[model samples]
Target: MNAPVRRRRRRLPLNVLLGLGLATIVVAVAVLAPVIAPFDPMRMAAGPRLAAPSLAHLFGTDEFGRDLFSRVVRGAHLSLGIGLAAVVAGLAVGGLIGLVAAFAGRLVEAVLLRVIDLLYSFPDTLIALALVAFLGPGLVNATIAIAVSLVPFYARVAYSLAVAERAKPYVEAARLAGIGSGRLVRVHVMPNIGQSLIVMATLGFSSAILSAAGLSFLGLGVQPPSPEWGAILASGRNYITKAPWILIFPGLAICMTVLAFNLLGDSLRDLADPRRTAPQRAGA
Candidate 1:
């Protein structure tokens, strides 16, 4: 008589679930801004200037009398879009550079690593600020600056992970079997390193959003009249004492966006940890 084998299913952690839920809500808000927002985000006198939260204007009105809720909803597109675009750009370019350095000859690897190290020496924010200053202000340039600043981080992560995978017994076995370099990477290295890259990208997204917002706050990001979270915050700076709602709401939006992504990234890292998964595999 043979006993049946029960496949084990991993349950998501509570924090992960919460994080996913929050992130999903944020994405939905960004996607549905046109339909969900009660009034035009840019319309002047949507209500009384600097009105506080109420049923009529959920997040209240700005100093310019625009609906705070609508502006926040609309701003989500720009903020999230910049973060997403930067993360993708950084991940694609940096990940490719790292993969090449890992698999290429030692001379190539050394040169690439030195360049990465040089870039890594500066703080990411400083790099972004310098690039933005040089490129001039606006959404597109700000995104490019943030993406450039993020490259070293993803490059380092990808390089290390790929190197580790390359040294693995399975990868060595594949190489000895006369697999081509491209095929080897496609079959062995990439699958293993991919999850880590995704986790890093998730974490990096929060940083991108914060950077973009900071640049906008400094008047080096999305220009005026374009409903952006940081720009909204900037607009309210002078009205902090008189129209606290303006500052408070946008600040809260930024905080929520950052927090949601951070939580999601942390949860993903925990889920992907080998130590955490090992016990489940052993039990199964």
Candidate 2:
């Protein structure tokens, strides 16, 4: 018999690959910025103020003559940090509230739902802005505001998923077998919804980063002279006619990063649920 050829795996969408590649580059740049950047992110070049793209400064220099590339490089840390921290906070608050809402009687669900609704009433950016207004501007406060606002989203997602899982036959069987409420909820409900929770976290990360950067742009985030991407954008925006790269680079960075997570989340939605796979053909 002739030798059978192995089928090559299908190529992923070009956008997916590009997004992933860009994301990887951004991450590497962010993480290694300290070692890679030539000038201190804070260093102001007296002569290079508002300089455009050139050999000395790859991404060009801002109106203050601070190296735009270096600032953008360092700013990645602030943005990523806010996103990761906010998501972690969301996981803790939301996971607990969700667990309780799922198992507790109608009254508890009603109360949590009310709180969720109240939180949802405030637009996300507005809530963050208000909180920042009260707490005073800074990375920590901005992060807290973002995290608190995001908590309700995760809680609701967890609650709905848990409720669905609780109604499953296995859960009923466990209850009939005298499984305790705490253990039943923990053992049966959490595992089934874990994948969904992860998906939410990834999405939350992208949102949080964008929020943080936006806040920084408004001067409520990383603060002045720190070289955060948003702060850089804000500073360089006035000089857009002179040096557009300052705004362009950071803006693109934020856009690409957010898009990457979105694409990754979609891909993960497909991969995360094993049961979502198509039916297999019977062997001959």
* lDDT score of residue 58 within candidate 1: 91
Q: Over the stretch 143-253, how does candidate 2's per-residue lDDT look in tens digits?
A: 898888677777877887788888889998998899987998778888888888887677677877878888889998779888777788898788787778988999988
Candidate 2, position 104, lDDT: 84
User: Could you tell me which residue pairs clash in candidate 2?
Assistant: none
Q: How much lDDT does each candidate structure score?
A: 0.85, 0.77
Q: Which ten residues in a row have the lowest lDDT in candidate 1?
A: 275-284
RMSD values for the candidates in order, in angstroms, are 6.3, 7.1
Candidate 2 is scored at a TM of: 0.87
On lDDT, the candidate that comes out on top is 1
Model 1, residue pairs in steric clash: none
